[model samples]
Target: MYHIPNKYYYRLHQIRPRFKNDVENVLIYMATCLSNLSEMPSDKFAKAMNNAIKLFPGNANKKDKTINNWRTEISALFGLIETDSINQTSKPSNLAFKLSENQDLVEFFKYFLFYFQYPGGYLKPHEILDYINQGILFKPVSYLINVLQEGEKITEGRFYIDKAETTHCIFNDLRVTRQNNPRKPKNTAYLVIHNRKNNINYNWTGDVIRYAGDILDYMVIADLLVCHGNKFYLNNKNQEVIVSFIENEVIFLDYIPLYKKLNLNINDVKSLNDAWFYFVNSKLDQEIFKTDLYKYLGVDSTTYQDLVLDSINEFESKLEQGVEIKTKEIGDFGEGLVLGHEKMRIKRGKREDLLHLIQKIPTQFAVGYDIQSVEFDERKRYIEVKTTISNKKINFFSFHLTPNEWNTAESLKDRYYVYRLAISKINRELHLIQDPVGLYKSNKITMSPKDGADITFTEESSQKEKLLLWID
Candidate 1:
């Protein structure tokens, strides 16, 4: 019989870390120290943990208990590394490699936090958390997310949780501690965490609050929650992640094979990775991942369409958020600025009446440029606008050019103009690039080896235009 594992936790040892950075510093240290070593011995693991403390800001001199918790609770529990007792060795997960030096902590958490859950093997080593009882386990993160996203409609969401309420939900909420509370709203299976045995140590109240708070802080760092004081507001910008919590939270894998993989000691990072690849009848589970949750979506659970549809929807939702919308807005604004500037330049010319020819092309057309305008010489100038919003001053400018756009620019040569707009609240400026393809061919502009085009300017690099009265 398995234990009722509805548990969330953090270190309760001497040095209690309330910040995500503390965890980051530890991981960063270990990733660097262990990068070359595939299998780390126990003694080396201990040494790494000790050095990790010194790496933390202010050098708090945390020792003994904190190091142990860092290894068992945070590191293994969070799936950063796995232990191999049979071989007397431990090794870092793929995540550690990604986070090996200068990784952005929040972006790391976005991928990492998916593995964070209450009832997983993370709590298996802790006596209090792994307290034995045979019952169906619940994932606290998903239940809480539903309360945050659709709370007003659901019974639990109807109640806003402050510190006291959060404590209540963790410790005393019967809906979580018991299987079926009459008070639990109809058709809501999420609130049921486990069946109450009346033997659970209620003295875990203080520890429960600390652990629950830590989980909330994790969500905040992952940009899923905006925590103001003790209350949390859903960060609507990351609805993609929230809906993810709604979607994938239900499928519980058969960790039995994983237990065998590590002799029931290591948390099994491989198992977590395997869970995502159910397409080939993954080693952990033989059947489908789509569960009763699919009923609400009106999908025929018997079909293969679920996986394909799920993927497409995820990509589409991600595109609708953050950079895509704002990029379009900035691109439009930048093109408008350059169009006005071009009109002003051509105003006094004999072909001033040719202003009608200067028009902004809709970006969706993908005609390889943004605007059709004229130089003072009335040359047919194909203007491609690349815009970025930076509130601070910087020396360099960078942007992405699609293959089609790059080809068109190369063909047009000097007849093509690139209006690189950097807009801020107080200033709007344009660095004009005529024949960017020629500049690159001659090694005049810096084209980065990475994702986008990078340009650093000198006197001969580009023509600068100062824009004014643009905001009003």
Candidate 2:
């Protein structure tokens, strides 16, 4: 249940790192400190980090209280630093050395935000246990992105999230319900954050804005969100990148497991390291692409139902006029076409129960195939859907393929398909090329050389072609 605090304020109970442009500098500095220490206890490492910050340019007189803890855990969480109880030593991780060389400011934080989660290594186990329960497991940055993506308006080409709504859901107490799809529990763990009707008080301390807003600020610095006035929107130019990232179901180990492991034998240093490593690396497993947005958002809003209508209408209107949309948008439209057809095919076959088996792998996964389905005979099919809006004649119509997709087609020869939709203001046609790699092997479709190359198919001459009238 969501508690309307004394003033509707919500705070993160964990200590957050200094989220700024120069935050990378602190990490770089910590990497330097870790260089000399092969191994050390947590307390000594903490003290060393406290003194090391003073040597940093701007942190000369910075308070020494929590800086050390932040340095250790933040670095540890992002794989920048490592702890090993086996040798009683700490070392900078390989990523730390790479970050020092690349000096990618935005990439640094993006990597961190992708993995950062609540009940992380920042606080002592007791502190984390005080507030964190099975009820409160989340990846704040991912959750923030998920919520922001919630308020996206595709028709307007705008993506903005409700500041108050997102803050309350993440920082304030809410009824979180976990429902594992029994058939695919590990594959799909559903976490629903429900909106309760009554106002209750949650004593989470710290400035609500400071706790929540700082996270949003970090996302902005990482080129994920752009702030306008009081609103937050997904960075338009970075939308493709954002789409790729928001699907990451980073894991966070639950508190109970850690306590159980820690309680067994604190003296077993290597086991302790094993447990600590698991704790830091784990995150909430909520895949954005497969999940229904409203399930997590709580309210029975039609936002979920409206996304498809808005996006498809906008895309169709643009396509019907031969106006170009982004490459990513066109790609999504193609996949949606195939997905709709798959669902319809299953329903018509009187097998609605198996409808959930069809899955669309998001672009970020770079898995080559866009949709995973099955033939009427129950044979699996991996489809790469390509949509093109061009005035090129049917004789000249062709689609580009990534090397990954082509290799996948070559590997899954019989099970692979290319659902290419050529759309123009004058007409629309769908081409289904099964076993495109086999077609190539039989010299049916010519492969043109380009970046990742394009598979050229002239409809009049190919025996492996089918006109998909059912796509409409």
User: Candidate 2's residue-wise lDDT over 1-472, tens digit each?
Assistant: 4444454232455555663444544554455444444446756766776776565555676776556656755664466566775666665555555444333334455666776666556555554553343333556665556555553422234645434444555455333211111212111112111232243333333355456666776676566777878667776555655766767575554444544343433233223334555454334232321212123123234533544664667668778877766533345645665676676677778777776777776555788899998766677888888754322222224556778988898889888888776443234566778888788778988775444655667675333332222222
Off by over 4 Å in 2: 1-11, 18-22, 32-51, 58-79, 131-134, 153-157, 176-206, 253-472
Give each model's whole-structure lDDT. 0.51, 0.55
lDDT of 1 by residue, 13-70 (tens): 1123433445644454455444434667857865675665454445567666665665
Model 1 Cα displacement at 296 (Å)? 31
Error of 2 at 326 (Å): 28
* Among all candidates shown, the one with the greatest lDDT: 2
Q: Which stretches of candidate 1 lie over 4 Å from their true place?
A: 1-21, 24-37, 57-69, 124-136, 154-160, 170-174, 177-208, 250-252, 255-472
Report how far off residue 456 is in candidate 1 (Å).
27
Cα lDDT for residue 212, candidate 1: 62
